[model samples]
Target chain A: MGNLNPIQILVDTVSVGGLYALTALGLGLIFSVMRLANFAHAELVTCAAYAVFALSGQPVAVAIVASVGTAMVLALATERLAFRPLRSADQTTMLIASFAVSMFIQKLLIFTVGSRPKPVDPLPILAQPIAIAGAQVSLLKLATILACIACLGALTYLLRRTSIGLHMRAAAEDFTMAQLVGVRANSVILAAFVLSGFLAAVVALLFVAQTGFVHPRLGVQIVLVGFVATVIGGLGSLPGAAAGGFLVGALATLLQALLPAELRPFREAFLFLIVILVLLFRPNGLWPAPGLKERV
Target chain B: MTAYAAAPHAIRPAERLSEIWRRSATLLVLIAAIALLALLAGQADAVLQRRVIFCLVNLVAVVGLYIFMGNSGVLNFSVVGFMAIGAYTSALLSMPAAMKGTFLPDLPLWLGAMQVPHMLALLTAGVVPALIALLVGFPIMRLSGIGAAIATLSLLFIAYIVLGNWDSLTGGQGSLMGLQTYVKLPVAAAVAGGAVAVAFWFQETRWGIALRASREDEVAARASGIRIPRVRLIAFVLGAFVAGVAGALFAHFQGTLRVENFYLDLTFLLMTMLVVGGSRSLTGAVAGTFAISLVTELLRQTEVGVTLPGAAVTLQTPAGLGDVALAGVMLVIILFRPNGISGGREIDEMWRRRAGRKHRKLPEERNA
Candidate 1:
């Protein structure tokens, strides 16, 4: 373990965490406004990956645009079709419906593209590597980190500065009050979904670039991770989700590095155990909302 | 309580008889039809017998789901994971040494050293999952609403990841094989029937009533002195036990098991069955299971040459198109009639009413 490359590990962890944070931000945004978990967020990520793969022959900018656009469409469609009707229904109904939609979209993907995982070619810009702090890191890793930071900065700016962002925050705080203030609650919610979708697209590209493949079931895995991150950071809190995502990612990487050779395969289980502990002790999450009573 | 005494004793005796008649009629008819079909279609080949056994295996799982979802209003997404635990446990216990050694060479020295009887192995299988559920449910039951669901989903993911990676015990991605297939149709059906009966009896008990009340209004139930978490834990453990039994049956019936087969897809299917069948009634559970299974089978079978007019489509479908379609339909039903097919009413309730009507008519005729 001592002989392992520390610099490489740090770089890798940051890159991975950046991707998770980006994806989680989108998921968190939708959750904050709509109070729906958006289980299909991972599928939007996958759709982005597919979009990139399909447009790989084009310039990198076009490919990225295509991926993000595809995810936006998915986000809007999911909100309009699956969630809007259930907005007034009980929480359980919406949760179940989300699960159903997840299944539907996952199976539809399976039907369209066989169940097998497909290799996705990374863009040429992602291929170049740069040596930093005695560690060789792919240019894409740096780009992903920068992209995540830039997007988060933009999101923070939108939320704190812009009128629409203020409306979104208002809706998040109290939907009825926001509506009374002449905020189009539904449109604000839709905007959150769109933003989340775009974030998922970016994360999807990063994931495929890192993992090299995408499958129908990939979304389920991502959604679970996103959910865990959201819970750990505190549900309905965007910054917390980002922080949680990075924390989980860092912890997972450290655990992997520190684990005895024989227990290396159980790395994920160990990480989840940590999550369980966090949940058990702090049911409201690491960064619970101030002055807000958590519902049982 | 005084209202009971106000009812005439003579009328009670007549009502009891009528209730029995009403409750048993549908079950009796269904049983007779099945029996007749079994007799007429005598000596069904091994493949068809296996298919029937498979349906019964699913029936057991759906019934297990009915106990919690039907009575408690908890959407338990971890049943499939519990089933996986049961399947892998049974598979490890029942596998021949040669097969076990070949696939799971890294199995612990003690486990590799001994071979257990198949029946004991199967029993251990069911017990193991139940025990795990009991342990897990303690903390999980404290969570309410979507929190519980998320916790259970976490459990499912953890179980699946463990099962998939734990190559020593489960053979990992490689299918667990070489188990003796002892799950005949009659045995599977009998087990399923027994599960339904147990669930039915449980539903009538005090604990069941408490659980139902909690489901209706947790605050009111708590105010009424119901230990909500304990009741939920009991439901979770019991449901998990039934799922384990189903898994054991499924493992033996298929003669092999794979971790992937019992993960998210199967979990969704089970949830669909419970929801589509009406999460509030035992009859809905059984009916939903049979209906979904038969429809799935029919769709898979009919995927040959059917095509719709004015569509550039073929009737050809994949292996589990029926399940996908059923899930979609169930989603629609959930959207429109969230109470499900039978809502909360059991078949026995309808039968009791019909029997009471018949008894009243008999008295009228006698008087005439």
Candidate 2:
């Protein structure tokens, strides 16, 4: 392994890790209330990415608003049309439904836009390399880190201060009990979807900026990484999801920097091995929500 | 004779076997009919024969899924992973020595020197993956529901990474070509039928019943002294063996195997087929496979369309339409009939229902 600067690696970790953190946050939010791990969240990110690319000729502000709006609408519609009907269904059933929905959207995009990746240099400014203490960093990475913090900060504020947030927290804690005590289930669930959708849209935009292209099959890796992060942090815990995301992202990028060139391709394999070890030790995850035991 | 028609005096072992046969008669007949139909089609058109054979091979794999996911009520995502192992094993064992030398130069000396008969390779193919499953399926089966899903998914990832990167043995993401094509229509039919019989037999076993009990409710199964993990593991290994056999058949059918063929796409398709037919019954596995296969073939045909009344109009079917259609159908089935088209009931059960009898909800779920 060649020596890499510690500062550069840290920057890489924070930037990449922040995207994963946002992804895990969305998953954790939806899971907290519905107890359904939304497999379609990643697909939603792809949708937003495509949205931005489709609106390339438009002003950046218009594109951002459109892409974010598209993701939120799609999220809400899926919630209303697909998931809401299966609200009381078994976890597996809902999980499978989400899988079907995700695949359906992905395949639809492939058919419509073609599966090939298309170059999308939407924001040249975000891509410029900035020298940080004699280390080069992409402006997008720094922006991603900032965006992640802002989203998390906003979520905390909403969960702590607002009535809707209080209702959401209650529902997450005990869905039936919250409803029994008069928390409006519909609005709270909808809000969760909207918030998560926003996060996905944000992730999608950043992903496009970093990758410089949009492919029909993109976002799967992102979603899977996010999912692993969520599980590692604590499946149902919000803070845990973010922490897990950041930690896993950091570890991944660090591995990329540190691994021998010949062994670089197997980095994911090494990462998964560590994840399996962690689960064996702490099956409930690193930061499990209080009082929740694996019943099965 | 129906199980209902059996002597009511005592549940003798001989009579129980007869009753079991009777209960599964409808499903067995349907499978036999499919075989007969395949043979008949093979007489008429060559391409149709090939398609039917491919579908039958897939049917065997889906049935394997039912044994594990259906019985234990846990979805095993690493099924296609096991199939990859089986396929590679079979491919390596039976490939012409010269081709093996060329394709997989890094193979061990003895293995590279050896060239087994197709029959022997097929048998070994089933055994190897099953043995692997026996050794490694424990920590996975210990977790249930979401935990199991994640674990098995990770298992799939691990398997893909290993198999994909193990260039020495698996041809390193390239096609492992020049394998013998020993799978014929009759052979595929026989394998598929045997798979159906094996799954049905397994479900009648005590372990299968216990696993199903655990599926309905875990605490109660434990209270009744059912060792959930052991039973689930047994089902898992057993399922992997059958899936391995299916994989071996798949390798022989394809004649050239690729690592990319056995991953997320097929894994999810197998799962969808299992879920669509109903994950609860053997008939569900068979029905789901055939139904989805038919839908897919029909959609693929649309990629070369039929002339309409107004004009010789043919809609240009886009890429991945078949998968899209299938996923849409799965979503509809999940929303409307979450248990699947069979609702966990077997074909014979439907016959029994039509014979003027009330259906028995699975006993454990009755009180709930």
Candidate 3:
């Protein structure tokens, strides 16, 4: 702890935090209106990662386009086929359908491409660490942080100033009431998912850049982390989801760096203990919407 | 949407008792049918006997899932977390003294120097996870709906990480081995039968009714004097107890404790079983476990190679065919029967509908 540089750790924390927060924001977008925690988000992220790997040796710009495009298509397709039919189903039922879609897609990928982890080249030059002030940060880390900021900015602007954003806000508050009041249900849901898909692609690209590998299971841990962060942030609250994601990401990184060496291996256990404490303090999550009181 | 109407205010005690008995009797028949399957498997082949035992173990876990998820109407994704805790606890306490000496040198003298009998270890396994669930439920149960599900998921991750990395305790990532293969078809079938009976009985009790009422409408249940969190906590602990027993049975049945087995893959498998079979009743849990296990068995055989009945030609099957087929079937079930195969009704209830003693009412107004 004494030798650790505070600035370096901050950068590390934010980079990881940004990745998680971005993923959570994507998930929160869909969940806000539809109460469905799409397990297929994992698939969408994996689709993006594989796109990058499949397009290796291409220009970075081309690879990014491929990754983002694949995620958007898969996200849109699954929403149309699996989830749309279950639109009026129970949240649990919709959640299960998402799981089935996830499993089906995962197996399909495994069968079609083989279940091996392929090393991804996210541009070798971009892999190098660059010094800023007294701290060193990898180009990938810098990119992830910047991408998160830009995407978050764009998302905020869209939500605040756009007509679709107004519809989305109304829909999230009370989807049925919003529809009853003449909000076009399909377009709002569609826009939320499309933006969500784009954010997922962003998360996937940053994650694959950091790890330099892509596999069918590539997005499992990230999705898990982001899901928890979204929960901790508060369901149906965009700002809460973002805050929760950053908190989890930072806490996770901080725990690893701060713990004594012998306890490092069990860092996750400690993190979980903290999560339990947080739940105890704020059962509806840290930023639960004031109007949505806990009933059960 | 219509306001959720309140349930009828009163029912006679005699009527309640008879209703309970009817539900219990139907579940007993389901158990007996499974027992018959176990007997037939034992007579067929040794491999089938072991496979049947595995199915029974899975039955216990899936029923464990139903106990909380069905009654509470909360989709819990953390039963395997309790299972892992139970299995690891049993493995450590039940390991032979000599092996424990070598494998877990850091184990304190008391736990390492002794090897408890299997039954005692199993009971301890059940109790430990129950207590852990109670502790976890203190916080997690306070949150309802999606928040509750996600918080419980954190518990699962915590259990997995601790079990995977605590090398001296768990052998750290390597499989925990040397567990006695003591769980036979008869033993597992008996335990599973007891699990069904326990679940059925629990659902009839005051706590169970209160929890189910809360599931239907938390505000109405609360208004009627149900302590929502307390009822949920009771179900959580009770469900963890069953999961713990299943975990003990699994460790003995599989002869090893691989932490990875208790993670997401198994969690999803058991949950799918619950959902497809119907997450609301013991019949669904039992039927789902049986159906999925049978399909998996068939798939496993063909996953190597299959020969045509008349033609001599052999066909190579792909790996993960079972998972693919099972998931596909689950999707179909969700599409056609969103309430599950049993449609959340008990066996006797289904029989009543078939006999035309009860007419089908409109489904709860939900989006399709």
What lDDT tens digits, residue by residue, belong to model 3 across residues B1-368?
Answer: 00011214354677556655655667778888878988898788888788888899999999889999989988787899899988988888888988887777888888888789888998998999999999878767867766676677788888899888988788889887788888998889888998888888787788887888787788898999999989899999999999999998999999988888998779888987888888877788888888888888888888888898997888768887777787888888888887677778778778777787743342332323
DockQ of each model vs. true complex: 0.39, 0.61, 0.56
In order, the TM-score of chain B in each prediction is 0.84, 0.92, 0.92
Task: Give me the displacement of residue B117 in model 3, in angstroms.
Answer: 1.1
Worst 10 residues of 2 chain A by lDDT: A287-296
Decoy 2 TM-score against native: 0.94
Q: What share of the true interface contacts does candidate 2 keep?
A: 0.60
- Most accurate candidate by TM-score: 2
Candidate 2 lDDT over B28-85, as tens digits, reads: 7767766786778679677777888888999989988888999998878878988888
Any runs in candidate 1 off by more than 4 Å, and if so which?
Answer: A1-6, A290-296, B1-46, B306-324, B350-368
Worst 10 residues of 2 chain B by lDDT: B1-10
Model 3: how far residue B251 lies from native, Å: 0.8
lDDT-based ranking, best first? 2, 3, 1
Q: Over the stretch A1-296, how does candidate 1's per-residue lDDT look in tens digits?
A: 33357887877678777777776788778877777777778788777888887787788789888998999998899888878878877667777888888777777777777788888776555777888877777888887788878888998999999988999888777777789989997889888988898888878877777777878776666667778788788777878899988887787778778888867777787767666667777776798643235334
lDDT values for all models: 0.76, 0.84, 0.83
